[model samples]
Target: MSAPITVHRPSPTGGRRVTVNGAIVGLAHDDRDLAEFLRRAGLFDAETILDDPRWVEWRGGRAHHYEAA
Candidate 1:
């Protein structure tokens, strides 16, 4: 199984950081950018990514969540 993707929002700056299996992938400005990064990394597909509840959680400003995409 793939490692769960962890999304973190750091203090002050309010930037989004994405990490897979403990390795930092990239910092995203928004959900769309995060999805695009995941797609390029072969973690998730375009069809179900945006519509998934996990993505919705992040968009809602949840600090952290484990997404096993």
Candidate 2:
């Protein structure tokens, strides 16, 4: 099964689109923003879970990369 959370590629203006269970959550420019999104989604310890494959799936670019090139 795929991860429940997906961090899409960064846009030309920067920031990545985040989704949960196939529904749009918000745009995250950095780890802080991502943690907040997860917090709103009822996920605690989001920082520790960010790199966990079972929790998040990074796409289009490497994880934590928010600059379009």
Candidate 3:
């Protein structure tokens, strides 16, 4: 059986990646579905994201801002 997923924001600038069951899954720079997948899988960390400016995708691309809050 597949292990549970634990998502965390990417550490590098412009280098997006996701974690699932201790495994890494690369994410597209502007893939909205990828964002949803992370959220649904209980891997998203909002507080950690807003606390770090560099990891923010605000300026990456208009198509990448998947959050409205």
Per-model TM-score on C-alpha atoms? 0.57, 0.94, 0.30
- 13-56 in candidate 2: lDDT tens per residue? 89999999999999999999999999999998899999999999
Query: Candidates sorted by TM-score, descending order?
Result: 2, 1, 3
Q: Estimate, for each residue in 1-69, the C-alpha lDDT of model 3 and write its tens digit.
A: 432433244336553455545555555344554555555656476344432444433333342343322
The lDDT of each candidate is 0.57, 0.94, 0.45
Model 1: per-residue Cα lDDT at residue 26:
82
Candidate number with greatest TM-score? 2
Residue 11 alpha-carbon offset, candidate 2, angstroms: 0.8
Which digits, one per residue and each the tens of the lDDT, describe model 1 over residues 1-69?
A: 432565665434556777755667787666676777788778667446544545433433553432322
Ranking by lDDT: 2, 1, 3
Which residue pairs show collisions in model 2? none
- Candidate 3: worst-modelled 10 consecutive residues by lDDT: 60-69
- Give candidate 3 regions above 4 Å deviation: 1-3, 28-69
lDDT of 2 at 31: 92
Better of 1 and 2 by lDDT: 2
Q: Which 10-residue span in candidate 2 carries the lowest summed lDDT?
A: 60-69
